[model samples]
Each structure stands twice: as C-alpha cells, then as structure tokens.
Target chain A: MPPRSAPDRLLAVLDAFDHDHPALTLTDISRRAGLPLTTAHRLVGALTAWGALERDPSGVYHVGLRLWEVSALAPRGLALRQAALPFLEDLYEATHENVQLAVRDGAEVVYIEWISGRSAVGVRIRVGARWPLHATGVGLALLAHTDPEFQAAYCTGPLPAFTAHTVTDPALLRRMLAEVRRTGCAVSVRQITDDALSVAAPVRGAGGAVAAAVSVVVPADGIQVPALIPAVRLAARGISRRLGWRPA
Target chain B: MPPRSAPDRLLAVLDAFDHDHPALTLTDISRRAGLPLTTAHRLVGALTAWGALERDPSGVYHVGLRLWEVSALAPRGLALRQAALPFLEDLYEATHENVQLAVRDGAEVVYIEWISGRSAVGVRIRVGARWPLHATGVGLALLAHTDPEFQAAYCTGPLPAFTAHTVTDPALLRRMLAEVRRTGCAVSVRQITDDALSVAAPVRGAGGAVAAAVSVVVPADGIQVPALIPAVRLAARGISRRLGWRPA
Candidate 1:
C-alpha cells in the first residue's frame, strides 16, 4: 500500500469506523487503518484525549459525543435534517411506514435521517447509510431533480441493478427522470428490495430549489400509489413551508 | 492570539462556527478564529477539500455533510437522540409544548435534540445549546444522577442565578438533587425565564445508569406540575426502554 500523508493517516483512524464496524479495539484500529502498532497507539491516544474516540469498559473504542457535537453543525446533515424532521415525524405518524430524509452526495444519496417504520415494509437502511442514485426512492427523487446534463452523464454505462424492477436502461432512466419532474415526485416500486416500494417527493427550501427528498418505504404487494402520492406531497409541502418556501 | 497547533488550528476553524454563526465568510472565519489570512485560507482550503466544510453560493462556509454523517455515529449525540426522539415526540404531541433531550457535559448540560412546540416557548434553546447544571430542568435531572462529589463541587458559590427562583444555595441544591433521585423526576419551576417552567426525568441506559434526560418546557403559571410529572416520567421510561433499560 502507498504510504499516506499525516492528514490521511489521522483521518484513517476515523475512517476505520463504519456502519458494520462502529466499535473496534486498538488492534482492530491498527489493522483497519493500516497503521503500525506504535503509531496507532499514539494517534488513538490523541483521539481519545481529544474526545474524538471514547473507550468503553471493555476497551473498545467508539465515536465520542464531542465529535458528534461538532458534526451536528453540518448544514446539509443535521441542519437539513432538523428542518425536515417535524414533517418526517408527521408522515411517519400518518403512514406508520419507514420515513427517510436524504440528500445527494456526488453519485450517491446519503440517508441523513430515518425513522424506522416497524409496522410497514422493512427497509434495511440506517442513518448515514448510502445507496446509488437510481436504486432507492429518495435517490431517484433527488437524481430526478438534478440538471439534465448531469442526469445524462449519470445514465451512461455501468448502471448496477439491485433487483429485477430497478431501472437499468438509459432511455428508460431518462423517461423516469422526466416523469419525476412532471409529477414532482418519484415512485420506485420494488426497486431496491424485491418486496419494498417507495414514494418520494422533492422538498424545496427558501430559494425554491430542491433541498432534500422524503420517502416512505412500504410493502410492494397491494400497493396504492395514487393514495400515497398526496400524503407524500403534503409532507413535502409542509417541509418546504418550514424551509421558507412560499407560493408566489 | 497564540499560535495554535496544526490540529488545534483546524479544530478552531470548526469551533469558529456555532448556532449564532452557522455561516461565515472567509474574513469572518479568520477573525473569529484569530488566525492570519494566509493560514486561515490554507486551513479552510484543506477543510473544504476534506469535506469538513462546504462553501455556499455566497462564499459563506458551513459545516459539511461528511462531518454530519460521521457525527451521527456518536453514541451520545444522534444515537442517544434517536433513542429518545419517539418518546419526545409523544411528549410534544401531548403537551404541545417544547420538548428537549439533553446530556451532561462536565458541569453543564448540552441539549442534543429539540422539538419546537406548536406554541414555541420564550427560552430560545436550540440544539447544541448549553446551560449550567443548576438552571435547566434537564440539567437538574442529569446533575441529580451524576456523582455526588461532582454535584457538591458544582453547588459551590460560583453558581450564577438566572432568575429569582433559581436554586443558588449549595445546601438547597443538594436537597433538590435528593428529591429528584427520590421521586425519579425533576421540575425546574420558573428557574429559567419567569414565565417558563420545565419538567424533566432522567433516562437510564441498559446498565441502569442515567444516560440522558428528557423534558418539556411550558409556561410557568397555572400549569399543574403534578399532572406533568407522570407524562415526563413515562417518556423517560419509554426512552430508557429503547436504550435497553428494564425495570428490575
């Protein structure tokens, strides 16, 4: 492996953490971060002393509250999530389904907020998890709102499909984006998982630009798209209103 | 200002942003962080490139999505908030007043989550806001659950009073802590604003230790504290259950 710079090395300590690996011991950190034991020891000490990492009674390290405090200031992360939460909660109460808030990060959509919908279709997404732009409902809604040129670029070869219903053809994907723009919403029916369908609407901010997308994950069988559309749109409008978007 | 270490300088740039100054121009960042123009530019460049900060259309810098995504992994921040949110929502829906979740940070309480009531209160607390352990209802609940030696140290003469009703005497504060522990709840009656009162309860973790606190802020006058106690305790109990706490 190529030797990393000081910043990269330090950041790798943090990089060692992920959804599947939230807790790690010093040996795990050394292995995952590709750091020598001594270097890992010093860096981990700095991180723990700085409260970037917390050591539990079991000597396993997890992300600490201090880093989370600093991170809560991210405008597109918790800031946007903060603005979208009441509406998400309202939608969850209405549907009792998985409610999610997502924003685009380059080619992927990162889940900024999620409320587990235990009674409805089971979705495997967790907070901060990500999926491609064409696979999930939130992803399609956000990708649909992007500029046509970027959309064209995104639809080129290498469209990986997760399920049989996922849109893999370029022309079909273009049509889907158009339909999303026209309806002001995107419905991915069993696109991510075989049994789950999602309906998503674009949320606008003060500038009248799409700020985020909200979606509901529901069972694919016996789905009612028409009925779900208005509720999703209403939640989107509520979030948009709170973001300072008003009708002209 | 003294020259800061490279890491500290980077952290200072982050510390430069807070609730009051969520967005900042380069000049604003340098001035607030007390760093020279050249150094601040270089650092901001690194941070933005690292996805720690995002530059807006107006050239204002904000904490970025990457940081927020990483922060969500913090057990004490988003993780704790996620566990407490449903119960907080129920409390908000029932009371129609401000609902908050907070954790103790040293001698103060740092609010990690907040749901603005339909009729918002006058206290003006936002997420990440800090209050002395002696002032806020959540703070009192957390302080009551913390080590007795720490509570004794906090109750010394340096206790600054917010309102006439604030508990300033060490002896009285000790008595208040005892009552909070005994009753399994805390009520800060008009300790913040004269028009405001807060009812808070401590949330226990799987280990049965007080992990956090939840509370509601309502107008001080004519509100029945006895009536609010059960609701607050129930919400706390619900969150505690989510955190893996069980009644013995």
Candidate 2:
C-alpha cells in the first residue's frame, strides 16, 4: 500500500486492535499498524492522553472507556439496542430462547445485542459477532429488504454454506428471500449450528426502511416455527415503532 | 490553545461527538473541535472513509458501527458488561426492579449496564451516564473500596447534592463509607433522586480488587432495604466470580 495520510496513520493504530487482538504491547502495535517503533510510540502516546487507548501496568494497551463512551452515541449501536431491549426482553420472556438484534453492515450482519436463555439451544453468536448476509435468520431478514440491485448482486455472488442445510444455490436463496419478504419473517434451521434454528423479522426505521432485524433462536428439533413467528414479528414491530416508524 | 499534533487533530474530530452532540456537520465539527475548517474537513473525510464516522443522506455525520464494534473490545466497557449481564438479569428477575452495573471513572460512577423493570421506579440513570461518587449506591460502593488516601480526598471534596436527602457533609459521607465497608454493601436512599432507593455491592476482579458495582433501584417508600441487600450482593459476587475472582 502507498503511504497513508496522517489521520489514516493514527487510525491505523486503532485498527490494529480487534476481536482477536484486544490487548497488545507497543511492539505488537508497531508491527500490526505498519508503523516504525518511534512513530507507534508517539501515536500511542497521543491516543493514550486523549483516552482513545489505555495502557495497563503490564504495558499492554487496550481500548479505553472514553472511546467506548463516544461510540455509545452511534445511532446504529447502543441507541438502537437501548430502544429494542425491552421488546427483546419480552421476546425472551415469551419464548425462553436466545434473542438477538442486528443490523446490516455492507454484506454482513453485525449483532448489536443478545440475551441468552439459560435452557435454550447453544448459539455461536454474541454481541459484535458478524455473519454473512445469507447464513443467519437475522441476515436473511435484512438481506430480503435491501435495494434490488444490491440484493441481486448478493444473491448471485459467492454464498458460503456453513452446513449441509445452508442454501448455496442462487435460485433457491432468491426464493428464500422472496418468501421472507412475503411472510414478513425468515426461519433458518441448522444453518450456523446443527441444533439451532432461528426465526427473525426486519425492523423498520422512521423512513420505513429496514434498520435492523430481531430474532429468536431455539433448538432445531422438536420446535414449532409457526409458534415462534408471531412472537418474533411482534418484537420486531415493537422495536420498529420505538424507532419512530409508522404504518401508512 | 496551542497547536495540536496530527494525531491530536484527528482525535479531536471524534471527541466532537458525545451524548448531546452525536451528529454534526463539517462546520459543527470544526467549531466544536477547535480545528480549522479545512483541517476538520480533511480529518472528517478520513474518518468517514475508515468507517469511524458515517454521513447520512442529509449530510449529517454520526458515530459509525465500526467504532462501536471496536469499542466492544474495551475491557471496562462492553466486555465487562457482557460478563455481568447474566447476573444482572438474575438480579432484575429476583427483585423486579432496575438493575445496574457501574465502574468508577475518576470521582464519578459510569453506568455500563442497566436493566429496567416495567413497573420499577423511574431512574434518571442510563448506560454511559455518570454521577458523583457520593451521590449513588454504586458510587458509594466503589468509593468505599478505594485506597484510604484517595478515598479521604474524595470525601473531603465538594459533594454535590441532588436531593434534600443527599449526604453532602464530609463527616457524614465518611460514616456512610465506613458503614458500606463494614456491611459489604451500600444502601443509598434518595441521594440521586427523591423517589428511589438503591442497594449496591462492589464486584471484585481476578486480582481481588474492586472492579465494578452492581445495584438495584426501587421505590423508596414501603420497601425493605434488608431484603434487597442479599440479592444485590449476590449479583455482585456472581459477576466477580465470572471475572475470575476467587474467595480464599
């Protein structure tokens, strides 16, 4: 890559920290950020003083509270999660299943909130976890609502299957999206995990555009999809109303 | 103000967004960050490209999902809250009141997680909200656990009163801290609000140092503080154990 701009260089320092590398030493930051040791030192110092990064007594740097505070202002992040929590809680109360709220980021769905039910089927999802647009119930709900061009491209593009049950054929996946749009919900069984099945619905924003998706995941065996659909759609609609959406 | 370095200028653009001003225009960013308009434009563009800031259809810039995803890695932010959520849920279930988890930042307590009961007393607190060390149950629990010299300095400092029942006198505050230390929990009545009572207990980390506090807020009238203490302390201890704390 060509030489990055000053702001990009600073951002590179932050980008160096992610899910697998939440904590790092100065040397690690220098190498990961592609900066010299001295440049990394100076930028790290600036970030530390500004509270974007914090250094522990062990000399490892971690993301800081101030950065988290600022990010809490993200409308797509905590704000949406806060508005949807009560409904999510209600969904969990009604179904005793793993409840989730997620939004589309490009071709992927990013989970913003999750409330696990102790006795529910085990899920491979957590807050900040991501899944491709075709692999999860929330992902299917969100993908079904995207613009036609994007939806077409995504359907025709590479679809990685997580299990034998996952739909990898473009024609079949397109039909699934259509069914989701028609029925107002998506149900995926044993796609991400063998025992888990999820039912999800799209949440609308003020502009009546799909802003997020709400889902409840349970054991694939011995569960009724029809019984789960109403509760999932109700929670999604409740969250949509909370986000300022009104029906025509 | 003195001229800032390249990284500082970049960080200032992010610092411009907060609870009150979550979205901003270029001019607003320039004014709030105290940077030249051209410099602000450049920095904002870089941030937007890096997914740190997002611009809407109407030209307003808001904090973005990428920033939120990264902030989730913060040990004191979502990571801590994630570990404590199950215990908090149990606390809410048992007490049917508002449950909260907070960590001290300077002399104030910053709420990291909150679960509100539908019929619970109205609380002014929200996630990422802050309150003085002497004005909240979580704050008192945290303050009582701090080192003696720092705790003494904080006790002697000006105590801002939120209601007539708030303990503003240094001597009284000291006694309250002593009581909290002896009881292993803090009971603060009408300190931050006129109609609520809170019982909080400090949560310890792997090293057995106080890392956070868990609390339950309920209607102040006709409630038994003794009943709430065990649940609150139990939730705190449960969270501490999840954080790798072990009792000798």
Candidate 3:
C-alpha cells in the first residue's frame, strides 16, 4: 500500500488510541500508527498543542478536553444523549437497573449513554463501548428496525458468540429479528454476560427512523422479561417523543 | 514564522470545526485551515476515509461518531458528567431550574452537563459552551476556590460588565470570592444576563481539589439566594462525595 498522507498519519496516531489502549506513549503511538519515531513525535506535539491530546505527569498521552468538547456536538452522540437523558433518568428511578442508550454503528453498537443505577447489574457497558449487533439487546432492537436490506446483510455475516445463548446462527438471528419487528421490543436473554439479561426497544427520531435504542439490564435467572418490556418500550417512546416523534 | 508542518496543518483542519463552525465544505475547511485547496482535498479525503469526519447529504462535513466515542473517555468531560448527572438531576427536580455541571478550562469554565426544567430561567447554556470566569455562577464558584494567588490575579484583570449590576470592581469581586469561600457556594446575581441569577458550589475530586462546579439558574426577581445556597451546596457536596471526596 502507498504511504499514508499527512492527515491520515495524524489521524492514525489518534486511531491508535481505543477502548483498551486509551493511554499511550509516543513509541506506542508510533508503532501502532506505523510511523517513524520523529514523525510520531511531531504529530503528537501538534495534537498536544491543539488540545486533542494531553500529556500526563507520567508522559502517557490521553484524549483532551478540547476534543471532548468538539465531539459533544456529534448529533448521534451527546446530542441524542442530551435529548434522552431526562427520560433515561425517569426510567432509572422507576427501575433500578443498568440503563443504557446506544446507536447502531455498522455491524456493532456504539453506546452513547449509560446511566448507572444505585444497584447496577453485572454487564457494565461503559459509554463509548462497542459490541457486536447480534449479541446485545440494544443492537438487536436497532438492527431489527433498520433497512430490510441492511438487516439482511447483517444477518448474513459471521455472527460471533459470547456465550452459548448468543444468536450466532444466521437463521436463528433472522427469526429473532422478525420477532423484534413484530413485537416492537427485543429481549436478549443471557447472551452478553451469562448472569445478565436485557430488554430493549427502538427509539425513533422525528423523522420516524430508528435513531437509537434504550435498554435495561437485569439478572437473568427468573427474569421478568414480560414485565420489563412495557417499561423499556415506554422509555423508548418517551425518548422518541422528546426527539419530536409524535404517534398520530 | 516558519512554515507550518503537515501534521500541524492537518490539526488546523480539525481546529476549524468548533462551536461556531460545526459543519464545513471542503473549500471552507481549506480556507479556515489555511491550507491549499489540493492539500485540503487530499486531507479531507483521508479524514472521511478514516471516519473522523462524516460527509452529510448537503456535502457538509461533520464530526463523526467514532471520534465522539473515543472522546467520551476524557476524564474532565463526559466521564465527570456521568459521575455527576444523577445529583444534577435531583437538583433540577428540587428547584425546577436550569442545572449545570462544569469544569475549569484554563481561565474559563466549560459546561460539561446541563438539564433545563420546563419552566427554568431562559439562561440557555449548552453543553460544551465556555464562559468567562467573572460572568457566570459556575465560573464564580470555580474561580473563588482556586489557589489564592490565581484568584487575586484573576480579580485584578479587567472585569467586563454585562450590566451595571455585574461586579466590576476588583475589591468587590475579591470580597465576593471571600464570601463564596465562607459559604461553600457562590451566588452570582445578574452577572451574565440582567434577568438571570445563579447559585453555584464547588465540586471536589477524590483529592478534594475543586474539580468541577454545580449551579442552578433562576430568575433574578423574587430570588431566594439564601435558600438556594444550601441546596446548591448540598448537591455539589453529594457529587464530590460520589467522586470519593471527604471533607477534612
């Protein structure tokens, strides 16, 4: 492949930072970005000066406040979270469980918001975390409502499994997707983590498209999936309404 | 000055996107970033390919969700807001006012979290918005408790006035800072906008440093400054405690 350009190289340095490797040294960034040491140092200096990255006392580089501020403007990220937060708070107060707000990103789900209940469950999905679509309740809820062609394409993929209960079989996942569309809610039963189960519903934007998903995770054994469905659906509707989606 | 390097130029492209300029065309990006058209096109192509910038239907480029996900990990931004949100919600519920959580950035305060009650005062400060140290409740609360040297230096500067009521005298500002220190909160009366008044308190981190500030904006008239003081202080203390702070 041809050598990357200036912007690609700088962005590659940023790409080197991820969920598992949020903090990195110059050498780490250089190696991960496939750039020479001098080039990495120059790019890092520019980024640090611009406040896209911050250097700690230990010389490890972490994302900075300026980048965070700019990123907050992402419509699907903080804007959606800002719109959904009040409803999410009400849901949390009503049911003290892990309340998560996520949006679909390709074959994965990107968690934009997570409200931790006083009593949280085992599956601690942090904000900005990504999980495969077939393995998460929020993912299935979003994927179910997505374009039929897109959904079919997703179901045709090699679905990875986290546990025995995960919908790794393409045929089974297609059936589950049909059920989700039929019922307007998704129940991911003990797939993400063995001890936890989740109920999720799609949140629609004013444009009537599936903009996001809201889910509540609880302990899997003796799970009240039926009872949780209404609450999850209500939260989804509440968020949808907040986003200007009116059921006429 | 020496010609800016490729990395610096690339960062300038990102810097061109801010609160004022959330969307940009290739031409706009090139002009604002001070790069040649050809250079800008090449860089934008790479950035769009890397998923840092998403091209919209109108051919405008926006900050992408992938970058937002990474930026969410910033400790002083989304992470702090995540920790402080519940208390902020409770405060909003209690007062039916605009509640805010902000952290100091340089000499300014950047609001990281905001919740507006339906009937709250018309003081609309968006998340990621920055305000000067002398003009807002969160700003005053943060500035008041900073190192004494820093406080004096700030107070000595030219205090810009929004109205005749705003504290323009350095001596008066110094006195107000003392009162804020004594009371564990800062009540900025009609500082930013004439009809708005705000009460703010310092939020401490695990090490008990003033890491953030919580504030509520209410109408200037019929203001219960004394009454709101305790509520705001309690909310701030609650968030600080959650962050693992314990008063000595």
Better structure of 1 and 3 per lDDT: 3
- Per-residue lDDT tens digits of candidate 3, residues B37-92? 99898888877787778898789998889879778767787878888988988898
Q: Is candidate 1 or candidate 2 better by DockQ?
A: 2
Q: Candidate 1, clashing residue pairs?
A: none
TM-score of each: 0.95, 0.97, 0.94
Residue range B45-103, candidate 1, lDDT tens digits:
87787787899998999988877877777889888898887788889888888889999
Relative to the true structure, candidate 1 reaches a TM of 0.95
Model 3: docking quality category: medium
How many residue pairs in model 1 have overlapping backbones? 0
* Model 1 per-residue lDDT tens digits across residues A33-142: 99998988878887787777899999999998778877878878888888889889889888888899999998899998888755777787888998889988888889
Which 10 consecutive residues of model 1 chain A have the lowest summed lDDT? A3-12
True contacts kept of each: 0.58, 0.89, 0.70
- Measured against the native two-chain assembly using Cα atoms, what DockQ does each of the candidate structures obtain, in the order listed? 0.62, 0.86, 0.69
The runs of at least 3 residues in candidate 1 whose Cα sits more than 4 Å from the true structure, single-residue gaps closed, are: B1-3
Write one digit per residue (lDDT tens) for candidate 2, span A36-151: 99999999999999888999999999999988988999999999988998899889889888999999999999999999877987899989999998999999999999999999
